[model samples]
Target: MTRQKATLIGFSAILLWALLALMTIGSAPVPPFLLNALCFGIGGVIGLVWIGFGAGFGVLRQISWKVYAFGTIGLFGYHALYFTAFRIAPFAETGLIAYLWPLFIVLFSGLLPGERLRALHVIGALVAFVGAGLIVMGRGDAAGAVPVLGLSLAFLCALSWAGYSVLSRRLGDVPTESVVVYCLLTAALSVPAHLLWEVTVWPQGGWGWLSVVGLGLGPVGLAFFTWDIGMKKGDIQLLGVASYAAPLLSTLALIAAGLAEAKPILLLAALMITGGAALAARASLKP
Candidate 1:
């Protein structure tokens, strides 16, 4: 696909990701780990159906366990932390914090072979960090203040995903079908965690079921595939800038769900973060 098409696809994935925070809001009928298990389980099935059993199994057999380990830690680890963060903190706050991956991506991307770390990249990373600091510290009202643990985990989610994106690029020739393995591994990991730590209550009703299904089919499942394709084929700088839009979209989703109110600080944070990320990626943003 052309870079433009790839970018559009990636942006669409961002929208689905925005919806994730809204979908998995309350806890009881489905705990964090259990939600993850269900989402990844259904996602894995979707992947399996898409690739068919024979071809999918062939790819799996060819890949090393090392690959699976990395994929699991990246994909599953990010989601687990993310879901838990939602449970502890306001979804909008946690999401903005987790959305730091775009900035981290710009920083980490320089580590790859043939990619040089530029001065603007450093300056921009610092600027973005400052923006994140503002977000973390800018809770002028007690109603929206995020807990320390939730804040920390959200940042960890960013770090985990940034590492994942860079590593994914480094791992040459891994097929898009690799998501199937990641989803399956995540499900396997999540099952034990859910059984041990969480009470296994199924989604309460149609709304709950819809959330699980939407997560699986949209963000957890198809979004991964589209993102992989975009990262491989799209304009890097463009995608970097585009990624910042996720926090805004996610925050908007929260507002629409009546789960959050629009805060001026969030807009300022968005500007700072997006501008900083854009600065970091300026070298590649050229047409």
Candidate 2:
């Protein structure tokens, strides 16, 4: 795919992820690990079905086990940590924290060959981080206190995702079909994780099941496939800038679902983030 097309595909994942915060509502009592296990497990099955057992299966063998191991850790670790944070803190707050990944990606890109960190990139990161601070401080959850552990885990989620995306660039040559392998690995680890730390509670009710299905098909399943292709072939800088939209869109989704209230502070935060993203994309906007 051309860089523009690939970047557009990557941006689509951002929009899909926006729905996740809303979907995660009422999924409670169910452990994060269990939820992720089912979501990614079903997603893996769908992937296998899409690729079939022919050339797709053949592609798996060519992938290095190292890629499988690290990729699964990055993807699954982010999900598990993100879900855990939601259980501990408000989804809106945690969502903002988790979005640090894009900034992380922009910074990490500097480490890659041929990618330089410009002055504007540093300013953008600072601006976006300031926006994140506003959102976190603006939360009014029961005395306005954000759990330290929850916030930490959310930041870890961002770091994990950054690692995953950067690693994807390194292994960009890997077949996209190999994502099934990554998903399977995630499912396998989740089994033990669920048994060890969480009470197994399947999603209940129609909305619950719908959320699960949506998550599997959207974020967990197809989004990953598209993202792999995009990260591999798209303009990485542009993708990083575009990812700033996810948290804003997710917060909006939450409000639309009545899971959160729309606030002026939220709009201000969005403006800051958008400005930072724009600055970061300034040079690459046409690329």
TM-score of each: 0.90, 0.92
Candidate 1, run of 10 with poorest lDDT: 20-29
Candidate 2 lDDT over 83-142, as tens digits, reads 898889777777777877777787787778977777777788789778878877776564
Per-candidate clashes, comma-separated: 0, 0
- By TM-score, the best candidate is 2
Using alpha carbons, what is the TM-score of model 2? Answer: 0.92
lDDT of each: 0.80, 0.80
- Record all residue pairs in model 1 with backbone atoms less than 3 Å apart, i.e. clashing: none
* Per-residue alpha-carbon lDDT of candidate 1 for residues 156-180, written as tens digits (9 for 90 to 100): 9999988887677766477778878
lDDT of 2 at 284: 41
Model 1: number of clashes? 0
lDDT of 1 at 230: 67
